[model samples]
Target: MVTKGAMLWLACTYDLDGGTLGHLRWRDEEVRTVILAIPTSTPQCSTSFPDNYRIDCNLASNEVRLGILNPVHGDTYTCSVYLSDATLKGWVLTQVSIIVPVPNVTLTSPVSDTVTVTPGDSQVYTYVTGSCRPPARIDWYKDGVNVTNQTGSVSNDGDEFVTTSSFTLTGAKDDRPATVQCRASNVDGMTPVQSGVKTLVVQCPPEIPTNIQEMENTETTIIVQWTEGFNGGQPQTFVILYRPEGGTKTETVSVIEQQQSTYTKEITGLIPNTRYLLNMYAYNVVGNSSLSSVVDIISKTNQECSYKGEMTSIPNLASIALFITSSVLLVTAVFLVMCIICRRKLRKMRGRENNPVAEAGVNLPLSPVGQHDISTERSHYDDLNLEEREPPSNYECLGSNAAANVNTQASTDDRQMYESLGTRSNAAVYDELEGPASRAHVII
Candidate 1:
């Protein structure tokens, strides 16, 4: 096979005697046109051929040559040799198969070099090649990476072939600004013609805001700041949703400026000593992003009020008053119960001291001596100044006044007993009386 713009030659030979007086003719079957003719009557080649063709006649060698300059594809050339007697001697056929390199490639689908599309959207791009022989092979590429699976078709326009290739582009945010190219090659060792670069702009929703922070706070306001995320190939703004902690009512605020990488918002008219929750997001014409991480903020207490640390719940005035009143009432009730118990114990102790014999459930015998003697003994007991006294021990009651007569005789023993009782402590005397009481008499 030869390439286009090359030369081709067709020759015809005949075996006849000398002075045969024959002529040669060349005809193209594709176009149905005669290209060149040579006659044996003339000494030189024919001058009637096209400027791109030539003819050579040699009667002695019995041959004729038809030379084609810049021959094209899909043409069958016929060289016929005949005598002047209108008798055909011999003929030859030459088929032309020329390879035409692709001239220029163009992207017809997108029209412009830059194409804008949203994420998850499919875009079709078509590359068409100029007319070529042995139809050009079309290939597609994206970001300099070859695309193996592509669709194409070839159509013949007269004598040349035109190839068309289509590529479907689908991508996400990460694949934005992708470059696509189409290449066409028809002949071996020929550089493939490349179409202009087509850029893909994938527009998508912005990413969630990051690095959320609480900058500053006051008694009735709070300041928040955050870093912006990807803008999704367009201008974007930030919005914040804020509310009191555990409150149903919410408020929304947006940044005044657009396309800023960092933003700050100040929220006002908030309650003092109150906790608040905040969330932020970025948005564009496409859509809004997911909510960012939550940021917690607590407003400061008023200057006159005592500071409460980081507590979300705020107690009302009525509740505080009620709590204090309940505590005071509980303390008063406990004190009254203690007073009643002490009074009852004091009354019981006084009764025991007033009538020791009756309290102890024991009977004591009356003194057998005269009333003067009893009075004298009671006087002596009063002189002792003892707060607690033990009952008399080891003395029997006498039936008559005769006990008085023995008083003088037992005077020494009574003196010894009195000394022993004097040695006893008040607690010892009280302990002896508190135990089971026995019937006893005093020695008058």
Candidate 2:
């Protein structure tokens, strides 16, 4: 376009450089001249090329020198040449169309090779332009598909047009990089100018963890484990929900943020010997995911013990029978030990009672009344034998052998004499006999 007060020139020439027609004079019949010129910026009654050009009809060349070209200069130029005469209508005509230049597209904001974005964040993909005539239309494509969440503006600086298109990207989706591009187009009908692909890196939460396992169990707790799928390109944590089976309320446990394949947790504060229901979920920047499948678990029960402090379980019928048998055996062992100890004590007492010293004290022998005198007159009595035997005093002897011996030793005269003695004297004579004869007692 030609601006007011700008110099401009318009010439009607066609492939005639150094040719025969090139040397033709401006008024020659074969030479062409501008028949019409239009500047759309001005009114029809006014000069269309007002002060912007000059018509120099010299002897050799007829040329129009322009001051400046602006948007008003974007008009069709028509030229004509007469074949026979200037007044005749037989002529060859030509036209020239002028327009703005094509645009150069550029990606301004995402200057680096790739742009990172997360879910729920508003990202701006800005497209700008270098100097261009006839401002271009900016279109955005995401993964080869056109996008509409965008805006555009165009401004001209007299010599060139500037265009800017900003695409605000926002949506909920899985984490993945997307290919994005911006292209510019205009009236020049040339190939569309485009910017290189700018990758959109997305981050979001992972899927629910699966394959929950009850690894270990105790009287008051359980050890649970699980496996996790993709992490959605972000770090994640886990939440575990647990409760007694068929109970109304539930308990919650959480795992610290992580991105590993497998995880484990110790779930405590549980009732002993109770059954439980449980599930797990994964958490990331976005939010928690759907709960995983429910699982069943049973807390361990306390173990019982026997009276001897041996560990045991609640007794079944068979176990009761076995316990009774064991009790009987233990009782029998205790009784046998007691009996053996009693027998040992009795044997020791009987041995002490049968000692020879005890028997000697129970049967002590007694001495005769005249045992001292007998010992001193032993030789005299032995020499005098029967004639010198002395009479005993006071007590009567009840020994049969002594009586028999006295009767046998006594003569007829002695018997008559002893019989004449009184009963008292006879008893006194028998009292003195003792020794082995005392064991055989005869009471007269």
Query: What are the lDDT scores of the predictions, listed in order?
Result: 0.70, 0.57
RMSD of 1: 16.1
lDDT of 2 by residue, 1-444 (tens): 322334444454333233222121112122332223222222211223444434433313433222224314344444432222233222232222234444577777768767666667757888887656666777789888987523278777665678888987763456467778887766545676788888777766678898899999877879998998656656787889998987999989988766467889999888777999999888887666788999989987644333476766754466789999999999999999999999999965653343222221111112243323333333222221122222333111213333554443333333343343333342333343332454323222
lDDT of 1 at 88: 76
lDDT, residue 109, model 2? 79
Regions of model 2 farther than 4 Å from truth: 1-103, 110-118, 148-151, 187-189, 205-279, 283-296, 299-336, 343-352, 355-444
lDDT of 1 by residue, 1-444 (tens): 677777877677677554464566677775443543445344445644467677666656777776778776666888776666867777778888888788999878888888878878889998888998878888788999998533269899778889888889986776648899888898768898888888988888888988888898887888888888877876777888988999999999988446457788888998887899999888888888999878888898754243575545456677899999999999999999999999999966764454343332222222322323442234323222343445445332222342454555454443454445557864554344344322123432
Which whole-number lDDT from 0 to 100 does residue 113 have in model 1? 82
* lDDT of predicted model 2: 0.57
- Tell me which residue pairs clash in candidate 1: none
Count backbone clashes in candidate 1: 0
